[model samples]
Target: MGVCFSTEIKDKSSFHTGVDTDGNDHSTNSSKVSSVPPTPRSEGEILQSLNLKSFSFSDLKTSTRNFRPDSVLGEGGFGSVFKGWIDEQSFAATKPGTGMVIAVKKLNQESFQGHREWLAEVNYLGQFSHPNLVQLIGYCLEDEQRLLVYEFMPRGSLENHLFRRGSYFQPLSWSLRLKAALGAAKGLAFLHSAKTKVIYRDFKTSNVLLDSNYNAKLSDFGLAKDGPIGDKSHVSTRVMGTYGYTAPEYLATGHLTSKSDVYSFGVVLLEMISGQRAIDKNRQFGKHSLVEWAKPYMAHKRKVLRVIDSRLEGQYTLEAAHAVANISYRCLSIEPRFRPSMAEVVKELEKLQEPKETRPRRHSSHGTRTRRLSSGGLAAADDAGLGAYPRPQASLPSK
Candidate 1:
């Protein structure tokens, strides 16, 4: 779970300002869109929102088959997510494998931060409806118990698909990676475009879930914060997020902005191209930081191939690789002012997906041929003499 420093209740601000790193003002909307309601201050007021259902604790228990171990789908800092069945029309509990399937997250009783996170999830998801955001079907709030119900995502998380090594978890194709990246970018763009401007504090690959057709949807809003209002430049809050993905400026100062989310997005994008964790201690010397080790290579057209996942086997064109490198480099800029807005990033990614003629592959200075290591591992070695890097083991808990 994400760490929280302020003990104060959630902010009650009515509106927020969204200034991109490049000084573009995104907070204003000329379209005649309905204004969002002010955030509810209490649990009672939040639960009263008409968009969500109030599920009795007993009903969820029955739906999840008494929270049996066999029904568990995944586990995380919040708690275990159990596969459950519910009636589509009445939203009533049903037998296993019957009716609509849902993922029920039962909060851990011992987690001190679980309640706050759970409330944040409901508060944000209840009011927002978008194709890229996870759907919250209902929530159960009983004395000393907190649980949330969500539409089940069949393909699991992008983290698993990109990092996990197994027959069930296939490597994401280059096209699929671009698709997921675009979907996630659109989701952040939606949050930033909101009249009240929500800063998604946590944006690592683990929080990006995938559906049956490989469509990406963002999950986990526990660390989300309302953007600064009025003339304030940013919302001052405690630094809280996964270590490698957190922006340097936010880590130094408690000031938070939408650009912080942009930095995290850059890290995820780099991970997709390299098939490496943001910070892998297991890596050899001088190669632990994905951004540090790969950014220089990304600067040059031919050298960029050095960092591309050898697993890709040159399936992606040199031009497309260079374009992605440019985007990530801008996003991971030391000065936030140099980074492009999410809207701009989305437009750049869309250009990559447009139909175009296939061009002949450009051979790198270091030959483009890739060969398997003798050890029967998935290591891919090229003529450049880059050493074999082991595949990362699954370290983070699933959402």
Candidate 2:
């Protein structure tokens, strides 16, 4: 992780201006689109509602400039995502076919996520409407092609900020970091606090996209599922998700639950604090895995200073670091009951900023304000690296 201050100094002004107390943004549309709120439905029920012909392939290809190399936004197990435009033939927006940027996720012919996963995305991103969740504009399923469209996220993924190395990892200011955490927590809270719990099976830095203002939106619903209930213990399924972030218990057994998400979130919080990936080649033996390495240190705040990223220096509050670290430790607890709900996580994260009431009566943080990281930087190499990070508090793995 090499998010260098030296490289980003030229763009520092852009970063500072993002944290305004003014909730009013010049670009935001005050006019709300009135529509009947989607009726509540389980994941399966929502999946059934995706209408195939709503988005034509011709429109998608045209909007994406025939999936031009430059139009590419991101990629995943699903497929390449391209920046696309609105046709307005179907929805008839004011913009019509011009200047309207949307992200088009075209599914690979033979993707690991498969058809069930596509349905899952349609189900969640389709029905859910929250500021913190990526807005799924629509999708296209014509013959073999399966494409998903989402609102364009200007700043790219959270992974780009936390662990991508060089300028990408350039230390985020304490304020922006807290803001990102709060936004992500709000999205997860919206998911888990619903009458039905939806487990985000794949919650990692790469899936958390940022707009121009550094606000986070949770994406990648292909792996999400309804979390366990009753004494059901865990929802069993084939193991999936990125390495270095999967929960130990779920990895050991197919059994999954809402707490699995909590564990993944703990890993994410650790990444934010340390400015390091969970596992990087730079780490010494026994310290390579962030979960195993940091457990003991997080349990004791006296060692907290050792775990925080050196790049931060005096920028962050030590007390704030300890508070968030402790919360992460609990989130990663072996027992599901010990883990806090997403709503609780959101509340704790909100406390990191200040009292919600403290903002000026008029200008509050409402719409997004993103600061772009400088694009070019060294991704990784053998570590000439930062020193040690401590372990989280000792706790037994659940049976």
Candidate 3:
């Protein structure tokens, strides 16, 4: 839910980059400053009331047959997402999937997300347009009901395919998995490299929605923040993040920065490659966690292959697997400085998939299968024309 980092949106110290996010200049760790937040049009109010161009409740209700439970697509941290339709005015072009099918996310009034979070979602997703980011059509907020309209993702979330109970879903092949990783990486890089950096506070399998082709669309920007500019290296704030994915520095000290997002991304990447949950409360004692179990292997670089998902056995090239494992190790490194930037990660994955003409490598050629074990416990293995991942074998639950 938190992508391992948990937080409640606090009243920021009067910062605004536009209608989307606000920056705090006068606020500090010791100084508590509060002023009225910038009054901006909430996406819901604007779409439903301000614009005749948007779909009305009656229009959506008629199409959805009065919000029938049968039309409900799925439920998540926000609320239920239902499949509904809109006329040509909503989406021109042509009709393929039932005339502009939209996803209606009904917010839980009793839940932790309130008006501010709802407004933030509308402001950001409403204007933020990208093929990889989920499209926000409009919203509706009346009385106890708060709803966000988004583009329907037919294939559902990556989590459903990865780790739903009793779900005998089709396994993601090596190439397809790599492709998904690449696409998701591209989305992260875009956000990090935007004119103004946007920190994705929550990044996990559930947040990565997949369309019919399994393309990733990052959703839920309730916790998205404007990163520090100029000489500012960190954003000072109380520690508010999920447990497993939170950076040690952020958790130990309230120094928020880009590295915090990188740490979460690393955990997500590890889960993608290995098909493991970041934290498994049901796991016995110490074994109930992906991070705790994989840390030893990442540090030493021996037996890291043992952590690879058994379901993918032999489906992935040894060299490719080793390179990805090595990258994952760097991503999960406890120190933020040790982790590679998102751009570096994208490059490594692209290289691991192809040859040096596109991306260079740590090894001269792939498939060498020669492992060099250093005294420090780093093992480098080559199976493709890429790099080596030398990690110690850390024991985990059996297949």
Q: Which stretches of candidate 2 lie above 4 Å from their native place?
A: 1-53, 87-97, 167-169, 229-231, 355-399
TM-score of each: 0.80, 0.74, 0.72
Name model 3 segments beyond 4 Å from true: 1-54, 88-97, 142-144, 165-168, 299-302, 354-399
lDDT of 3: 0.57
- Superposed by TM-score, candidate 3 places the C-alpha of residue 283 at a distance from the truth, in angstroms, of 2.6
TM-score of candidate 2 against the unseen true structure: 0.74
**Number of clashing pairs per prediction, in order:** 0, 16, 23
- TM-score-wise, the better of 1 and 3 is 1
Report the C-alpha lDDT of model 3 over 1-399, residue by residue, as the tens digit: 111001111111111111112333433232111211322333334433332224455555665556677666554444455666765464432222467777666665654434556676776566666777887777776667777777766555565455533322345545556766777777777778847476665566666766656577787766566667789987665444444666777666656677787788878778877777787777778767787787676544346666777656545555666778788778877788888888888898887665325433223223433232221220111111011111111111111
- A best-first ranking of the candidates according to their lDDT comes to 1, 2, 3
Error of 3 at 39 (Å): 12
Global local distance difference test of model 1: 0.70
| Better TM-score candidate (2, 3) | 2
Worst 10 residues of 3 by lDDT: 381-390
